[model samples]
Target: MAVYTHVSAEALEALLARYDVGELVSAKGIAEGVENSNYLVDTTRARFILTLYEKRVDAGDLPFFLALLDHLAERGNPVPRAIPDRAGVQVQTVEGRPACLIEFLPGVSLSHPTPRQAASAGRALGAMHAALRDFTPTRPNGLGVDAWRPLLNRCSGDLDQIAPDLFATISAALDDVERDWPRSLPTGTIHADLFPDNVLVRGDSVSGLIDFYFACTDIRAYDLAVTHSAWAFDATGAPVDAGVGANILGGYASAFGLSSEERAALPILARGACIRFLLTRAWDWLNTPADALVTRKDPVAYLRRLEWYRANPGCFA
Candidate 1:
């Protein structure tokens, strides 16, 4: 989504030569996300996404991500698949980084989604979980609850710089979340980072779900919690739209209903979701280079969400 590495015309042409995608007309850098270097590549025949995996992404995990996309696409989930070259290779080396030419799915990412869009996104998430039920490849959630404290610890020294008492507040929230973290729940492959930008929508229906870099094996409800935390709130972390949250839950339930246990654990899981993003955003905010072609998201945005979830635990009820 961000362009850390620049692709030259010659290099891009050489890369395109390996595939039958025709002559490259244009390849513009996409600067929306912080994870990988992405370019909107256009050739004579079609359009595609050229993603250069960054250091944060493990090259070893490329197969799992690509295969998951293929699986989801086969099962009717709106996901982009990696395009293989003439040698049947999906992963290629670009400027010493792993890269892939991905199918370009049509639709625009919404910044402030409507309730109907939220509902459709929720339904797509449910349907994704259903499709992944039989997927046997398992990748652990690297950013799960267990990683929250350590991540926050890395950002502890600089916490007050972002906000007064931010460290203590996050520490206490982490303590509570860890103490009450769900022991058992339905687990599966989940799109752990289904933020508004990750979802592509045409009308009220989900056209595609992009960015599987964070997909992993985790508690199913936790995925819903992540989506809820993402779609239910505005950019400032205010839950000003109640219908958005309700419609998300309703649409998800219609597609893949949650168990009673999952329902009960939602509030806590939501808190954990908040903390997870809070710590990661804080870490990124503190660490990302100023000159990097990416935006440093506000860490306190998730802090507001955490406070809201704490005061309104029954929001999920």
Candidate 2:
């Protein structure tokens, strides 16, 4: 049967042979993401994550993204190491799509992360920031302001139709955020999309983080903002048991220690973070294919977050 993504099982197995890993025992589809087709492959030795890069991910950025992960793993981060083939190539073509195998990290995502767990995520994210501080990789922020402008323009014409006042409110919010978007604030590689599903939790602990397709060089506070948007809320858009913004910040602060300027930027950056996902989900909601097994994540969820941020702008402080 044809999987929902780039290629099929038979083609993936052929590529696996190029690596040192033994025969592939089994391959199964993963339905978590809407961006790419992902699979869990069980090899003779260990499990691996196979992704067929799709439209949302540019084929060119693979080297920098993969190399950055390798760099982080080398610094003792729990990031998955990308498997290279016998020819020492980090990526290859599989099923007519650029494919790569990553060591499967074992962990359950915590729907209800404890205060300690929130703190752990904070530190882990902070540690990721520290490890990538001096990374020489240069790539434009994929989810940056310029990228969002087009979507905003698309939504503006129908603002009154889709969600009425809320749409107008978000448009205005984006304008406000742009007026003071950080021009310079300790730039580094950031996990621009750190949603809970992208994070792996093992026994109430985050064992690994997956999905670096959205990773890019940007303001460090923006990364923290993405985590805040992900880890601070429940699936239904309600606030979960985790410590929310305050606790997450505490954990992050204890780890890499945010500067006063960084701390000051958190609220606005958090607003920007809320707006970023809001626009993307809105765009995806309109664009996702009907036959796809992956359910489109709600853009309204981020709208709720934006509402929350608007009401309590001082909460970040």
Candidate 3:
């Protein structure tokens, strides 16, 4: 939510002019994101999310994320459709970073989701996975295994202060997967960060999904694993409520039944998924400047989560 790139009010006004929107009525910062400067823009035409890419987002890969949203919207996914400029291009440079205006989706994210909400989120995620089943466009995984391993090593010295057991367990888990992680497990386009905060809901249904910055090509089962790590776990990484896991998995299964093999891999993948987030948060915590306007999400939160996963390994079953 930091203003990494400076976009003036005049610049925003010009952007509104480019669209059919009559006038820029107002603009305000939307919190909860760390990688980009996002503003909720209100205009005569409609509300939209204007984003200026930051250090975390590679401008080169903007096309895939934007195009993927377009593809999903075209495929009937309840996602925000990117608004194109007068030149008919959905992506363009604004301020300093690659910028795009996305249609503002209605509804709020589940900061404290109930079991039913969790299930509904699962259903929506499954639908999104199915929607992008055959999407073959190429893009590198933003935080692929190789990119991730180095961070783990960098943070190894601090493991004792954080969560020592989880640190060792995660390192071992990653090693195990490196040896036998499947080369093929239904690969395709996936929303790697399908957290509750990224999902918008209206009433009992999921209305839209936002923040495609982490979207990329990866194993479909990995997507499910990421979703499980987000929706099914508590602050301590233990299953939140008795029915949370069942509801989520059940909803996803109804949408696209997981193979027995896929089911077997879920627990391991979930552990790896936890480690991925833990390392990323640690990297950000160590690297992020103290003066940045954005809030640094706690790396220790995921550390505790890893510990809980280690204690209650049966929860993944």
Candidate 4:
């Protein structure tokens, strides 16, 4: 998460007063993502994350995210557990915004994940879906097909300005997605943004799965599609290593069954995943000021992958 919301030491200390997480011995702002303001909070007992929810996060959706993390963490997903304050509330207001203290998971996100790492990620991802099968609360995927066009429209001014032919390519892809989007599939809770950085791998297996803010009710296979895009493709949409896709898909299939219909819809779903990231990243890239400390991911990276997906449908075997 980003650090758009500035928390002074006094403000942080005051916020920590509500929780028994020990004194905020120290805090460091995290700059990995663009949604919320996250800080690594250190105390006498353990390390934690102090996330100040930003405008992108809806106030009403906070409980769903926190409860889902707590549910999955208890079910062996290795996710960051939401630490409720002494008052027994998981989320509170800090710096005039909804904030949370999540138990920090250990391990670094892989920059160039190996086939084994990809496989483990897939397995862990599948386990998450399985664990959440009975979680009754639901939240719609705000960035899914219905939001794609509107997001595109918001970023229309910056598409061609960012790169030539970008708008036309994205428009065509969105059209294709809407025209043939799958009507029905296996529905379940999904970590909608399980990118490489969102997963933590210590060795051969995954130590943790972070960032459940985007988690929502969606097709289980669509989660695999997002993972495929995140793990198998490079920034230029070229294959980083052969058989990587098979490794991940194989690992996922080992834990979760994929039907023939799911297999047939993989291409379109992957394309939908591509468009989602492309539009969102482009929006962030264009809107975020250059001087901001947060990392601005290249939207074109997803564009490259989208083009590749369009040209090579059924690439996932």
For all candidates in order, the CA lDDT equals 0.92, 0.79, 0.77, 0.86
Residue 295, candidate 2: alpha-carbon lDDT: 64
Query: Which pairs clash in the backbone of model 2?
Result: 108-201
- Tell me model 3's lDDT, rounded to 2 decimals: 0.77
lDDT of 1: 0.92
Instruction: Residues 1-317, candidate 4: write the lDDT tens digits.
Output: 78888889999888788888778789999998899899998987789999988878898998898888879877877988778888898888888999888889889998788899888988888788889989999999998889999999888857998889888889988898999999788898899898889999899789999988888998889999999988888766666785667777888888777788998899999989999998998899888977666988888888888878878886876
Could you tell me the lDDT of residue 186 within candidate 2? 82
- Give the per-residue lDDT of model 1 (tens digit) for 1-317: 79889889898999999999999999899888789999999999999999999977999999899999999999999999999999999999888889999999999999989999999998999999999989999999999998888888888769888899999999999999999999789899999999999999999999999999999999999999999999888888988579898888888999999888998999999999999998888888888877788877888999999999999999878
Error of 3 at 239 (Å): 3.6
Q: Write the per-residue lDDT of candidate 3 for residues 46-132, one digit (tens) a residue.
A: 888888888888888887787788888998888987788777877767776678888888998887778888788888888888888
TM-score against native, each model: 0.99, 0.93, 0.92, 0.96
So what's the TM-score on candidate 1? 0.99
Which segments of candidate 1 are over 4 A away from where they belong? none
